[model samples]
Target: MGRPPGAGAEGTWESALAAHLAFRGAVLDVAGSTRRLSGELSRLGESHWGIAGKAAGLFVPHVEYGQSQLRWIDDELAAATRLAHAAAEVEDPDMQLALLRLAGPRLEAAMMGSMLLAVWFDFLNLTDATLSRHLYSVETLYVKMERWQKMLEPSMSALASLEPEQVESAAEDMPALVGHLTREFASLLDTIHKGAKVLETALVLKESMEALTMLSALRFSLPAMRPALPATLGVGLMVGPNGVMMGTRIVVSAEWVEMMRQLVRAGVLSLPAVSAAVRIQAGHVMMAQGHGDLPRGVRDALGDAPEVRAMRVTGKSGAGMAEPPRHHVMPNEFREWFEKRGFTGKMRIDWFCVTLQQPHHQAIHGGGNWKLGRKWRGEWNQMIMKALRDAEVGAGRMLTQNEILKIVAGYMKLYDIPMNFVRCRGK
Candidate 1:
């Protein structure tokens, strides 16, 4: 007589048991890395610099949270390892299948926990390095610090919502439950990865802007010195190698013009710069206390030109004595701009990527074909089928019809999978 519907194939079950053992070994390596990172962070926290000291203190809570999760994962992995070894020695298909089912959730929880912990570990390390290198007094650095902290909120919220207990409770079919947990955990990891990238990009931009602001100030001030200081600051800003001519009209590149417009649209340029530009274009100064009035004055002054058009003409042309644009944003406008981009949204991986690479893409589709290529689609489908087969073998049994469908649905949600492909076939 044929075996029961959920019965395991002997060779496949054995191979599955072996795979679990290998996975347990891999988890052990992750545990070692986590421990080392935790130790390194602890050492860094003992440093003496005030800023580093403050940042280290703030980072403690996140490290503690990660450590706690790591401990839980370690326990789960230890237990799973024990169960896998016992299953490997077993001859009965039913007994081995039962052991595999029991180990599944523990393994899933450990894997998810490890991934979440790694995200925090990486964030802490990056924050520490950034804080150590730059002073917080600089406006760009301060803004970068604030942005990093704000970005952590969503990640922390996601981490807190991770319910490993749910994994155990909901996992009726081991393979399907493992698949579901894998998808959910992967989605969370991707979110955290994108968030980290955003923070990194912010830091880079902050550093660049700080240098630009300093050089621009020096460029304007140095030339006005009594003896006229050497034109060191004019190296990049000046149109000629001889350095800037005091009363000569300055010329700017088309690229510089485009960049100023983008910076204005992003709300990163200072209100004072906008005000000064408006004054220059309109031939009269406006006493504006806030950004609302500044943008209006600018619009009226420039008339149909881009909001930042004055900036292109301000410092670059006409005697090189024009006021250079400041790199600070008005607080209210920055907050509004941030919110409009849905920075607080639950699934912000797409938003985060767009913000880091092309801020303009947030409001509109960044001009790309949405259709998947036929070859790419075929490759994706094959990969999915392979994953499903491996999952079944690792679980030591054929997944139920409902369990298979649920796994498919989880993949669909996780990847926004297209419906045009053939349904996944099961062994």
Candidate 2:
């Protein structure tokens, strides 16, 4: 197609809008992914390994990244629209070019503005959860110490009331009661100290996670796009009377790059600092209120009864004292159906890889793989029971990660065969 005069001045605004829309969609998807990942982490508990570990730490960062991107997109879109409208109103080529140049850095600033918001939102929930867990530990210590105080009050009262002859009997019991009280006090102090330490550790983790979040946001975002004047036929035609061809290179302003770099660095430093503060607050809360919030029965039992005390302290340190095992959610017929359909080997592995990497794409394949994995992991114990009930999968063999992957792949292949597969978007 032959170049139309002043075509660059006319179509630049339309092209900018299209590019911004594409960026907007991608940012929203990233935001959604962050949300989904956060929810998954919250559900999995702090103890669950793999993505859950990363998630516990990344929640704030994820939100921050998303928020930053979203804000940038919104601002960029608004500026682009205004510029387009302004361009529509302008008849002068020089004036239109001036408008484009002014809008360039503004668009870039809009794009980068989202980084702060992204960091703030990404890990907020995960950090909150960590704080909650720390506080819960402190509450436990408070309960222990409160019960000890109550027990000592009664002993102290009885010792004060005893008569001379009864003093002998009282004296004998006195040693035991004093010893019990001393032991209880020491135990309470120990628990308080331990809880404090845990709070400290959690604070550190939160700090580092926050720092990471900031770094990711600042370093990876788009910088401002500078407008460049076309340097070809126009300049040559203008200089024709002087018998000379002229050209100029469009250079993006140095200020724009420097501003972006600074913003990113500032975000990186600030996020960790904010997270550290949150952790410090949480730790203080945990240390001040150890075990105070536990059920009354549990508290009383800790101080008054030797058996209960042993169970609380000793059992806590032992392997048998752990929380009940979680169950999985896989079904009986799922494996059988897959085997019946001859789903195996490379096909299964390839699908598993795809589903793991591109969950959205797998969803289009009726997404049975993701659905099964979600069902299994969502409420683990129920899934285990269901698996146990099935003879083929249940036989003496426990489910492995590979088995789970296979099941997901098979389910995907079985139900999603007819759906057209769309390749994943973005690099």
Cα lDDT of all candidates, in order? 0.37, 0.31
Q: Using lDDT as the measure, which candidate wins?
A: 1
Candidate 2: what lDDT?
Answer: 0.31
How close is every model to the real structure, measured as TM-score? 0.32, 0.22
What tens-digit string does per-residue lDDT give for candidate 1 at 234-352? Answer: 22222232221121224222322233233333222222332332222221112112223434323432232455343221212146454222211112223333344332332111211
Off by over 4 Å in 1: 1-13, 48-52, 137-427
Work out candidate 2's RMSD over C-alphas.
30.3
Per-residue accuracy of model 2 over 1-427 as CA lDDT, tens digit each: 1222555555544433332333333234334534544444344344333223443543333333334444444544464445434433443333333333223333332322232223223234323434444432433433443454454334233322221112223323332333343344334323433444455664553353344332112111112112221100111111111111111221112222233222222111111111221111122221123233322332332222344222111112246655221111223235454444333331221121111224443343233365554454423324433443363455555544334333433343443421111112121
Q: Which ten residues in a row have the lowest lDDT in candidate 1?
A: 418-427
